[model samples]
Target: MSETADTLFSHVKPEQTGYVSGGLRDFFLYRDLGVAAATQGKVIAHLVKANMAPEKGTGWHRHEAEFQIVIMLKGWARFMYDDQETLVEAGDCVHQRPGIKHFLFDYSPDMEYLEIVSPADFKTIDVEPVCPIPDPTPWN
Candidate 1:
């Protein structure tokens, strides 16, 4: 965050936060943990949970940021980092190297994860697939 505001300590509680729509993915809900504001947009920390059954999933895309990571808190998710498929389960943490083309094609019903990315105002750009994307598992 080269051009960032002064950051302050933040203590956010569930009671003070609310999951809202209008995130990168419409299929998921995002709850800001107050980090972006506290950190003056240097970074953002939020909890994202499934809002609907997995269908198309997040298409192949990349973020224009210096750092990003996802920590699964419950359930599981199937992702393709380039040509390799990786299954992220509860307690798993994934560091998505900057500008890495990836796809989250499937996830459990109750899937929820904490995502932290540097520079709150990052950009998500759609990219051509690096490999064939797998169909999502049918929702029971």
Candidate 2:
């Protein structure tokens, strides 16, 4: 095997993960899975959780990565992918191609998901909302 390939391997247990305040937003938490280090910043794997409060979620934004995917692991979330509203629940998977406009409007208190993206650090460019959206339902 190539030395680069051999250097890019990671294994993480659920119990070994710890959540930290997501720098992008205060209403979310993130758990890194060592993918950045193993892949030499080529990829990042993380678990993201919605905090237990109703707040304007990640507004319309797009990633600067070449590839991105999200797999829901708990609860549900409502998102606006471009102009269409999408409901993502447990076991649902979403592949967000680079530059796809999306808005994460709201989510359940127990919402958690796995997100993998190319490049350990990706730029998120915020855009104006282009669709009518309902007021977020408060978390209990």
Per-residue alpha-carbon lDDT of model 2 for 1-140, expressed as tens digits?
44656356679887888899955678889998999889888888898998657577778888899999999999988988999999999999999979999988888989999999998789999888778776777865
Tell me how far the alpha carbon of residue 116 in candidate 2 is from the true structure, in angstroms, after superposition.
0.2
As a whole number from 0 to 100, the lDDT of residue 57 in candidate 2 is 72
Candidate 1 lDDT over 1-140, as tens digits, reads: 46434878799999999999999999999999999999889899999999999888899999999999999999999999999999999999999999999999999999999999999999999999999988888889
Weakest lDDT window of 10 consecutive positions for candidate 1: 1-10
RMSD after CA superposition, every candidate? 2.9, 1.7
Clashing pairs in 1: none
All candidates: TM-score: 0.95, 0.91
Supply the TM-score for candidate 1.
0.95
For model 1 the local lDDT of residue 25 reads 93
Q: Model 2 shows how many backbone clashes?
A: 0
Clash counts for the predictions, in order? 0, 0
Best by lDDT: 1
Model 2, C-alpha of 43: deviation from truth (Å): 0.4
